[model samples]
Target: MISEGRYKNQKAIIVENENLSMSFLPDTGANLASVVLKEENFEFMVQRPEREYRRVEFGGDYVEAECSGMDDMFPTIDRCYYERFPWSGTELADHGEVWNLAADVNVKGDDRVDFTFHGVRLPYVFHKNVSIIEKNTVRIDYSAENNTDFEMDFLWAGHTMLQAEPGTRVIVPEDCTCAQAVFTDSGRIGAYGEEFDYPVYRDKDGSLRDMSVMGERQKDSEKYYLKYPLTEGMCGIERTNGRSFTYRFPADRVPYLGLLQNFGGFREMYNMFLEPCTSPFDRPDVARLMKKNCVIPPRSAYDWYLEITVR
Candidate 1:
C-alpha cells in the first residue's frame, strides 16, 4: 500500500510490500526517495549520510540537494540549449526539467504508484509508474508523449544511485569486456571519450585496478557506458554478504548502460549509479550531434521499462 512518509526530512509518499519498501518525494522532483530490501534489512538506495535536502529552482544544480535514491532525468541530463529549430537555444535545466517540482500523483492501491509531470519548458508529458510486481521485484515503466504537432527529441534515464561499499562487485554479461569512458575524475582512466578494458585496468601509477569492485572512500570517481548493447540485458552488484540486486531491461530499447562510480570524489559520498539510458552521451545536444537522440513522433509516445530483483 501507499502512504505518507518522510525521507531525508522531506515529505514523502511510500509504497511498500512485505519484502520491499520504496519511499518517494512526489512534490519534490517525483523522486524515488528510498528503497529498502526488507529481507536483508538493507537500505538499498544511497543515503548521503547527514545531509539535508536543499530547495532548488528549475535551472538550479541537482547537486544542491540530497543527491540520493533515484531522480528522473528527462529530455536531457546535462544543461544545454535545445539543438533544433522552433525551440533552439531554449535552455534545459542542469538535470533536466522535471526534478524539484511538484508532480501529480495517482495511487493505484496495489503496491503501485504513478507520477505525472508536464514539461515546464518543453512540449511533452512524462509519466512514470512504480510497481511491486513480484515479492522481491520492483518494476518501473516510463512513457513520454510529444504534445506538439512536430516530432521531438528527448532522453529519459532513471538516475538510481545505489549504496556502495568496499568489495561490492558489479556484474555484467560475462562476454562483455570493454567500456567507453564518458567522465572520470582521475588519470586511472584515459580521461573522457576514451575506450578501456572492462573491470580491470592499469592505473596511471601502473597498478592493475579491478574496476568492477567498489573500493574504500577516496577522491576517485569514474563513469562509463557499456561499449556495446548487452547480449543478456542485465547488470547487478554482488554484496560482501552475498546478497545482491540486479537490473534487467530490454537491450534493444534502452541500448545503453552507464556506471557512475563515486567512491568519494563528488560530495564525499559512497554510491554508484546504474544508468540505463537511450543515448551514451549525457548531454542531449551532444547526443543529437552524435545521432543518438531518441525521439517521439507528433501525437505519439515512446516507452521503456526497468526491473530490479533482489536475492
Candidate 2:
C-alpha cells in the first residue's frame, strides 16, 4: 500500500511490499526526488534542494554532481529547458509537440516506489526505481527509453554536486582517463589541462600542478561527444576525513562518462562533477558523424538502464 509521510519539513510518500520499502519526496520540484530501499540503510536523494537541485545526493554517503541545477545564467528549476518535453505540474503526461513532459510517481509494492517520465521528439524516457532490501543498501535503477521515428540523439548526463572539504579526492578506474578541461569562455585558466589521456590531478590547494597549460578540445561545441571507456564499471570520489562513495554505471549500457568540478565558483572554488552521458552537449552534428546518437524507429521503443549502489 502507499502512504504519506514527512521528513525534514519535506512531504514524502511511502511504498511497502514483501520485497521493498520505498520513500519519495512528492512536494519537491525534483523529477524523481528521494528514494530508499527496504533492505538497506542507504537512501538515494535524486533532487534535494537543501543540498542542491538538479543534482542527486546519497545521504551520509556521497554527493554526485559538481555544478547542478540550471546554469547560473538560467536559475529557474521548474522544468528542464533542454528536455524535449518539459512539465511543471505534479503529474506526468504528453504535453504536446513543443518539448513538454511530466514527472509521474507510482507505488508497485508495499516497499517499492517508481518514478517515470517521457520525452517526446527526443527518443528517450527516464525511469528511476528504488527498492530497500535489508543491508542498509538501497538499489537504484535509472533507465532511458527511446521512442521516436528514427534513432535519436541521446545522452544520460547526470549533474551531481558534492560538498567541498579538505582531503577530497576524485577517483576513476586506472584504465579510464579524462579529456582535457574545456573552458566555457576564453581568458580564464581551465580546470584540467589539454591532455585527454591521463586523469586530471588536483592538490589540497586545488591547483592544476601537473599541467602548465590547458588544452583546447572543441568536440562538444562542434558536435558534443564526451565519453570515457569504463571496462570495470565503477569509479568514485573520496574524502580523506570522511567516507568514500563509489559511483557505478553498467559498462555495457553506458560507455561514456564526464567528470566536472566547480570549486570556488565557476571561475574558481572547489567542486567535482561526475557525469555519465550517452552523448555530448550541443553536438547534434557529431551524433551524425559518429552515428553514436540513436534514432528511434517510427512507433518503436528502445530501453536502457543504470544503477547507483552505495556502500
Candidate 3:
C-alpha cells in the first residue's frame, strides 16, 4: 500500500507487499530510497547517514546531496556545452539535472508505482515505473521522450549503490569483459585503457588483483565500464551472509555495465555499485568524443526495463 514514511527529514512514499518493499522520495530527485527483502531482512540499496538534499550547483558539484539510494543519471553526466543558453551554456550538474528536480508521482499501490520528471535544461520527459512481479522480484521500466525539434545526445545509468560487508563479492556473467579502469580520477591500481577478463585485473605495478571480492582494503576506489554488446545482461552482489541480489536487463537496450567500488576511498563508508547503463562513459563530453553517447531522435521516445530479484 502507499503510505508516507520519513527518509531522514524528507517525506517518502512506501510501496510494498508480503515479500518486498520500496520507498521513494519525490522531492529529492524521486530517489528510490530503499529496497527491502522482507524474508531475508536485507536492504539492497545504501543510505548515507546524516545527509540532506540540496540543489546541485551549475558545474556538476555534488557535495550538497546524499550519495545513498538509486538515482537516475541522465541528459549528461559530465559537463558539456549547450549551443543554446537556457541558463548557462554548459550542461553539467554532477550526475545530471534529473537528480535534483522534483518528479511527479502519479500512481502508487501495492503492485505498482509510476513517477515522471520533465527536464528543465533539456527538452525531454522521463518516466519510470516500478512494479512487483513476483514474491522476490521487482521490475523497473523507463522511457524518455524528446520534446525538441533537434536530436539530442545523452547518457543514462542506474546508479544502484548497494550495501556490502567485508566478505561480499560482485558476480558478473562468465563471458562479460571490462576495462582495467574507467574513472581515472578515482585512483587505480591498474593502468588505464587496458582490457581484462571480468573479476581479475592486471595492476600497473605488474600485480594481479582480483576485482570480485570486497576484501579488507585501505582507502581506494576503482571503476570500470562494461563494453558494448555484453555477452549477458546480468550481474549481482552475493553478501557474505549468504544473501544475494541480482539485476537482469535486455542487453540490446542496456549496453553497458559499470562496477564502482569505493573502499573507504571517497568517504568513511564502504559501498559498491553495480551500474547498468545505456551509454558507456561517465563524462558526457568524453562519451560524445568517443561516440558512446546515446542519441535520441527528435519527437521520438526510447524505452527499456530491468528486473531486480533476491535469492
Candidate 4:
C-alpha cells in the first residue's frame, strides 16, 4: 500500500509490502524517517527524539531538532568555501542544503517512490528513488545533475543512523582497516585522524579500544572514517537478539564508510551511524585537497545506488 501520512508531526509518505514498511518525509529534507519489519515490528531506522518540533525561523539552527533519522548529505558535509568549482560561494550548510528545504515526492507505481530536491544555493538537482525490490530488501537509487554551464565538484553520503544497544555488532568489510576517530568534548577514543586497525585502536596511553560494537560505553562519543576500501562492497550491524540490517553498494560508486558512535554523548543521545559516502572526507575543501571530490559536467548527470536488506 502507498499513502501520505504524518510522523513525528512532519509530513511523510509511506510504502509497504507484506514484510517491509518504510516512511519518507516529503516536506523536510525528504528523509526516509522509518523502516520496519511488519510481522516482528522491528524498526531498523533511528527516529528523532519525541518532542514538539517547530520549524526553524531564518538564521535558526535545525541540527538540534533533526539530528536523528536518515538524511542525505550532498555538495558537502562540513561548511567551507568553494574553490576550483564553478560556483562562487561558500560551501553547503552544516549537513548540506537539502535537509533545510522541502522536497517533492512522486509515487511511481505501487512499489517505488521518488523524492526530488532542487538546489537553491548551487545550480544542481538531486533525485532519490526508493523501491521495494524484494520482501526483505529495499533499493535506493540516487542521481545528481549539474544545471550550469560549468563543471562542479561535490560530495554525497547516505547519512543513516540506527538504534543500537550495548550488544549491537557493527560489521564492515574484512579489508577495512585504519580508522580516524574524531574527538569530542564528552570524551574520545583516539586522536583526530589517528590511523589504527579496524575495531581496535591503541589510545595515546597505549590502551586498546574496540570499535566493533557500541557496548556499555557511557559518556563516550567518537566518529571514525575508515581508510580501507570496501573490498566486499557490503557492511551491516546486527543486534544481539539475532535481528540484523545489511547494506550493499558498489565500492566504486561509494568509496568510504563512516562509523559514528554517540553513547550518552552529544546531547545525551545513544545511536550509531553507518554511513556510505562517495568521498573519504566529509569537508568539500578537504575532499578537494585530497582530490577525492566527485565532478559533474555541465548539463550532465551522475548516478549511483545502494540496497538494504533486513534479516
Candidate 5:
C-alpha cells in the first residue's frame, strides 16, 4: 500500500508491506527518509538526507534542516556539509526547495519514481531524485542533473543514521581501511596534506581508545568490496547481537561510504552515513585545489543507487 502526507514544509511518501512500512520525505527536514522494512523481530530506518543535525544536544538522531543555516544541521566527524555547484546567493538554499513527484509515482506497489527539488544553484539547476524498484532486494536509484548550459559541480553524500547501544559492534569487509575522520568543528585534520590508510575506532576525551572496543575488523577485504564493485566501501557495526540493520549503496555509482556513530546514552543511538559522492567537503577552493570536484556537463545525466534490506 502507499500513502502521502505533509510534515512541516516537506512531503512524505509511505510504502508498506505485510510486516513493515516505509516513509520517504523529500524535504531536508525529514532527515530520516527511505525504507522502514520490518518483519517478525526486525525493524530498520534508513536515512538519506543532504544534511542532518541537532540543537541543545551533543548527539541524538539528527534533526533535518529546512534550510542551510548556522543552527540548522550540524556536521559531525563523519558527515559534513554537502555543497552543489553554480551559485544561488544562499548556501543551503542553493539546490532549490520543492520536491516534484512524477504522475506515475501516485500508483502503488513495486515500481515507483519520485523527484525532489534538492535546492537551487545560481545560474544553473541542481536537483536530486530517487526511483524505487521493489523486489526481494528493493532498489533505490539516485541521479543529479545539470540543467544549465555550463558545467556544474556535484557533492552527493548520504547522512545514514543508525540506532545502537553499548554492546553494539560494527562489521566491515577486512580490506576496507578507515579513511581519515573529518570533524565539522575542527575543519580537516589528520591527513592534512595527503590521503592515508586509517582504521575505525572511538576517541575517549580526544584520545584514541582501545582498538578492541571497535569490535573485530574483517580479515578478508575482498568480501567487503564484493558488495561495492567500483570503489572500496567499509562496513562497521554488525547488527547480529543488538538492534542492528544494514544499508547498501551501488559501489560503482557512489565511490565513497561514510560510517558514523551516535550514542543516545541509554540504549545508544548510532548513525552510519553511507555517503556516495564525487568529492568530499574541504571548501570549494580546496576541492579545486585537490581537483576532487566532479564537473557535470550541462544537459547530461548521472545515475546512482542505494538499497535498504532489513533481516
Candidate 6:
C-alpha cells in the first residue's frame, strides 16, 4: 500500500506489498530512503545518520546533504561543464540536477508512486514510477524528454547504495570477466583507466584479491566500470544473511554497469553501489569526449526500466 508518512521529519512516500516495502523522501531529491525485505525484516538501504532533511542549492555539493540510499544520477554523475555548442561551459551540478530539486509526486493506490520533475537548468523533464509489481519483485520505470531543439549528451545511473558486510559478494554475468578502474580514493586496486580480471583480481603488489567479496573496512573506495556493455544486463549482491537482491534491465537500454566499493573510505561508511547506467563511466563530458554518452534526440524522449527481485 502507498501512504504519506513522516520519516525523521522528512516527507516520505511509502509503497509496499507483501514482500517488499520502499520509503522515499520526495522533498530530499526523492531519495529512496528505505527498502525493507519483509520476510527477513531486514533493511537493504544504507541508513543515513542524519535525522532531518535540508534543502540543497541548485548547484550545491551532494555530499553536504544526507548521503543515503539511491539518488538519481542524471545528465551527468560528476560536476562538469556542458561541452556542446551553445551550452558549452554551462556548469552541471555535482550529482546532476534532480537530486537538488523537489519532484511532483503522484501516488496510485497501494502499489505505485510516480514522480515528475521539471529541470531547473537543463531543458528536460524526468519521470520515475516506483511500483510493486509482484510479491517478490519491485519495478522502476524511468523516462525523460528533451524539451529543447538541440540534442544533448547525458548519462543516467541507478545509484543504489546498499548496506553491506564483510562476507557479502557481488554477482554479475559470467562474461563480464574484467572491469576498468574508473575512480579510486586510495588506489587500492590500480590507477584510473587500468583494467583487471574480475572476481579474482591481482592487485598492484601481486596480492590475490577476490574483488567480488567484501573485506574489512580498509579505508579505501573505488568505482569500477564494466569494460563493455553487459549483454546479459544483470547484477546483484548476496548478503551475509542469505538475503540476495538481483537487478535486471534491458541490455539495449541500460547496457552499462558500475560497481562502487566504499569500505570505510569516504565518510567512513561501509556500503556498496551496484550501478546500472547508460554510459560506461561517469562524467557526461568525459563520456561524450570518448563518444560514448547517450543523447536524447531533439524534442524526443528516452525510456528504460529496472526490475529488482529480492529473495
Q: On residues 1-311, what C-alpha lDDT tens digit does candidate 2 reach at each position?
A: 56777644545566445434444544332223333444454333322445333323211111223223211110111122332332222221211111112347776766567766555434355566656554434445665555444444344454444443444666666765445444433313233334333444553356543321212232221011134456766655665544444556676665655555443444243444555544433233343455555433445543444344433
lDDT of 1 by residue, 1-311 (tens): 77887876688888788888888898887787777888767887877667577667678888887778888888888888887867788898888887777889998876788889888889888888888888888888888888788878788777888887899999888877888888778757786778888878777788898888988888978888878767777888888888787889887778778898998998888887888888777887777777776888888998888898877
Q: Which ten residues in a row have the lowest lDDT in candidate 6?
A: 48-57
For candidate 4, the per-residue lDDT at 229 reads: 61
Off by over 4 Å in 5: 5-11, 26-31, 34-37, 40-42, 46-110, 122-136, 184-197, 200-237, 240-244, 264-272, 282-285
lDDT of 6 by residue, 9-35 (tens): 888898888788888888766778788
User: What lDDT does model 6 reach?
Assistant: 0.85
- Evaluated at residue 245, the lDDT of candidate 5 is 48
**Could you say which candidate leads in lDDT?**
6
lDDT of 4 at 214: 73
Task: Please identify which of the two predictions, 4 or 5, would achieve the higher lDDT against the true structure.
Answer: 4
lDDT per prediction? 0.82, 0.42, 0.76, 0.78, 0.40, 0.85
Full candidate order by lDDT, most accurate first: 6, 1, 4, 3, 2, 5
From the highest TM-score down, the ranking of the candidates is: 6, 1, 4, 3, 5, 2
Compared with the true structure, model 5 gives a TM-score of 0.62
Q: State in Å the error of residue 161, model 4.
A: 1.7
- Alpha carbon lDDT at 187, candidate 6: 78
Better model by lDDT: candidate 3 vs candidate 4: 4
Weakest lDDT window of 10 consecutive positions for candidate 4: 52-61
- Ranked by TM-score, the better of candidates 1 and 3 is 1
RMSD of each: 1.7, 9.4, 2.7, 1.9, 8.3, 1.4
Better of 1 and 2 by TM-score: 1
Model 3, 105-224: lDDT tens per residue?
Answer: 876555777889988777789988878888888888989998777777677888888989777988888776566467633455445555676677766676777878886656777778
135-242 per-residue lDDT for model 5 (tens digits): 324445555566667665544554444433345565555565545444322222232343334343344246553321332222211101111222444343455464
Candidate 6 deviates by what RMSD? 1.4
